[model samples]
Target: MNPPEPAHTPQPDVVAAMRGDLADWRQWLARVIVLAYAAAAGLSVVAFSKLCDLAQQGFASVLAFNPWTPLVWTSACTAGVVWLTRRFAPAAAGSGIPQVMATLDPAVPAEARRAFVSLRLSVMKAVLTAGSLLGGLASGREGPSVQIAAGVMQHARRWLPPHPGISEHGLLVAGGAAGIAAAFNAPLAGVMFAIEELASRLEQRSSGLIIAAIVLSGLMGVSFFGNATYFGTIEVPTLRYSMWWPALLLVLATGGLGGVFARLLHASITGQGDRLGRWRAAHPVAFAAACGLAAGAIGIASHGASFGSGYGYTRGLLQGHVDVPLLYVTLRVVATWLAVWSGVPGGIFAPCLAIGAGVGHDVAVLCGAQADASALIALGMAAFLAAVTQAPMTSFIIVMEMVGGHAMVLSLMAAALGASLVSRWIARPLYAALAQAIIARGRLAPAVAAPSR
Candidate 1:
């Protein structure tokens, strides 16, 4: 004690270094958590989608599925799922893409955060979206899977210590891209989608995390599902001058039709369709039941062709294992609109893909293009998706990866461009418009959520 406590003091340099180390540790921990949770989310989506597929088929089989059985069951189940969504998780209603799109906006209101992105919303989406399919709503799990994965990553971000040095927008963007990559097993498309659709300009600091998450999540998907084209082995024939005619026709048809569909869908949801949209808003439950009944009736008319996600039918057509009648395409388009219009939790991606396949088959048959059947179907699916989402790069890349269409990349790119241009005449971009609606509703802004010191 006498030798004294000469100056027991910490060095400023050492102290500053310690603080920096702690900050870094916190951020790294958050990032690690994001990656691990993303993998788990991706795996869950795969399993859940498979389960939904099984449920749809099982319910159909048990009911003996006569014309009336499918009609009654599909309608009844639709009404039940709608009730559940309305009572428990209204946010879980509708395709979740719009909600995720809202997360990337700097001007988004703080109050809207819980409605659009949260752990609770994701779980409800998983349970209810699966339940909706079991009701034969003709939807897909792939789209909802994106919102679910984003929720997981968003929740995981909360585990970080205060001041983790990550931006809120960056976290959401990275999570979304990771989700898409994992869901489709298309990592490159994930990055492209984030760049094109989510953010206007992605800063260098945030890009690394985005890439890492996509790679990690995509690997997770690959590990669980095994490497395979989404619709099975697609036979992309070598392009010829003769095939160019069909390609051009497909681009125009898919782009125009897809644009019209997008505009109609937006109009219905935003109450821009006047009386019908107003009526829907006024009587949400009854409207949902009516939509369900319409869906059931359509399913019966189409002989169940308009049921589930249209995955099997589309894949069958592409693999040349089944013949697709034009009536099937019309019924699917009608079914999809009815389901989406009902304010039920569903996605347009798989249904659109199937519709496009049906369109392609019709085009091929009508035009007598024997050699370009596979190419036409691929072109339609890619082009229609491009037109609907307006993220042409992501659309083509995802279709390319899923269908193994690298040999026809030029054709695919052309189709996407054509579709995008035509779609522009139909309406404002879909996701951007929906995101703005969320912002206007919530009144959140960039200044509301400044980084905490």
Candidate 2:
């Protein structure tokens, strides 16, 4: 009893102990904050889907009332959006993924945060992305979704009564994952993508928060979408033992091609940016207009095949309904790459998936073995995504969720790993290269320090 009393007397101040406990509690609370935001993000996806559906319906109605009416309106809207972006928020041009990466870069200055997250920039992104969709641009919603979600989270953080003491990088990563989860209705993939592709410095501790946020967001998304699969139910055919070798060959071919596409996109986008800066110094509007006109022409030629996220087209590819020839796939790849490269406010996520599916379809036909076409499409998706993004695990998870085929996990994993390895050997990571280009251009100030906790 005397020894116990002496031990108790030797303990540190009670207040200090309480303070330490309070700090730990605050950290836990902060992590919960990210998950809560993720839930909100999932809700946002459902909302966005509704908005898109309404927009499409409205356009159809307007077209019915007066044939060619919506196209005219869409053209005007596109031009207006281009003008707004050129005049007010040039940085909002293109996919905004690089912008998010720029913000998270430890080399960028904190003082420039306002410029990156400005209301004007956010508005411009919204308007342009909406206009692109209406005007039949070969773009996807995911990029604008990422930008808008990130802006929302950034502002939300500031609004907290006493802002959490976590770093902005954490919030940015969480926001991006939420955006992807909401956009694609694939929350696990979003979380894995953030960890594998976006995190400036990955760690086990940070990964836990990202995973929690992604799961919450995904659940929220399912609530809105009624748990429907994004790509519908794909009936994957069981692989015959003899088909394994051919499947491997398909994976290698697509992986190599995907790597080439990623490299080409990186070169064109950055090169065009540089050339436009010099050639169109006083005519940003003209540059944007040219991009819009090219997009419109491409849309008309492709007969809307390459437009939007290619969601319908992707489904068609998987179902073998599109009859998309290799040439069509090539054309789509080039058009989508150009649309994004020209600084249109859109995403490459859907387009890339479609490309991968198309490539897979072609490979399946080439194999001439009556393989499961849907399964081949799924493998193509994982392989091409891994090649482009260099995130094999994320790509694998995303295809699995999109197709809802856990049975094909082994095939997907093999394709993804093989593709990722081939792509890494062939080309640099896409986002990293994009980030470097942004920094080299001096469009963003260098990061001053890593965000502090």
Candidate 3:
């Protein structure tokens, strides 16, 4: 009682502990670790981008040698790449966004999650995706970039302390956001993608980490690629009230087609009660070779415009510098679907956008809105993406950032939302459905193996 009256002096150790709590070395270290991995992931993506460019250039050289080179070359190379994917990294196949989504899901077993985002799987994904492009497959790098970045950030979980504020889910989301930011050089779009596509909801604790990752990774991307939009800006005419009908028509058209494409892709990938899918599952390599040959034939018919990611073709169309055949959309869609159906490591983003551009160009010509074709092309790009992914916010934001089409923001929004709504009636949300399939497969594996044991 007397000691209490005299007021107990604070113990030095206790005071030091309080001070240490304020310092929070572990918390700081966790932040540092997250940031370091994010930068590394961004740089890795930049390197991958370079690899893909080289691959595309290499394929262009090959295609120039002979218009039919892809028939033999693409077939053989696709067979080899698919074999490698199946033999070494089955998880590396496809756009990989589904795998990332599955990893973030709690229902996916911990073992399956690790396998999905493992560094080894990521390396295979990059190499095989580059190989796919080198073989003249119609694929994009953006979706694979998301998975690669997530895998890189997944490694941080090992180094980080068990802190509530820093979760594996947050890291994966941050990594994916960083990937998009770095890939497109669009930080705001990355954030929107994180919230809209990657994470269902952005928690308060993870928001800072997500932003930091995007900033760090975005800086790295800017360092390597400069601060330019992915598609570069276009001189869009000031939109008028008369333009509304054309925009609506473009949205409906692209959204409907995009939905069909998504449905077909999902059915093929899941191998669900389809004869062609069953054949694909049974003879993956042979199926891939056939897809390559078919896609190659289509590319020859399109004068090689349907091969690779269709980036140059899409950009040229956007700039009104190139005129594709009326059948370009049909050729591109079939070729892209074939490539994706092959189960090789590739993405549909660029190819999908290319298809949309073709659709828009055709719609404008048919509707006698040629003057606003550029704007419609841009709208079609956004609309198709939104329709396919069912993520209108992410789609419009990404397209807006890629093209610097701020003047057409409202139009872009209307197109994106309208297309997404239209798509819903045609197909389920693509990535989410794919992710669920992945989770189902993962759960079945253990149970199926238990019977064997």
- Please, what is the whole-model Cα lDDT of each candidate in the order they appear? 0.77, 0.71, 0.86
The TM-score ranking, best first, is: 3, 1, 2
Q: Highest TM-score: which candidate?
A: 3
For model 1, where is the 10-residue window of minimal lDDT?
Answer: 444-453
The local lDDT score (0 to 100) that residue 175 gets in candidate 1 is 69
Between candidates 1 and 3, the one scoring higher on lDDT is: 3
TM-score for every candidate vs. truth? Answer: 0.89, 0.84, 0.93
Runs in model 1 deviating more than 4 A are 1-24, 441-453
In model 3, pairs of residues that clash are none
Ranking 1 against 3 by TM-score, winner = 3
- Candidate 2 per-residue lDDT, tens place, 179-242, comes to 7777777887777768776784554556676667666777777777757778777887767897
For residues 286-325, write the lDDT of model 3, one tens digit per residue. 9999999998888888898889998898899888999896
Q: 174-262, model 1: which lDDT tens digit per residue?
A: 66777678778888887887788767667677567667876777777788778887776677776778887777788888888888888
Q: How much lDDT does candidate 2 score?
A: 0.71
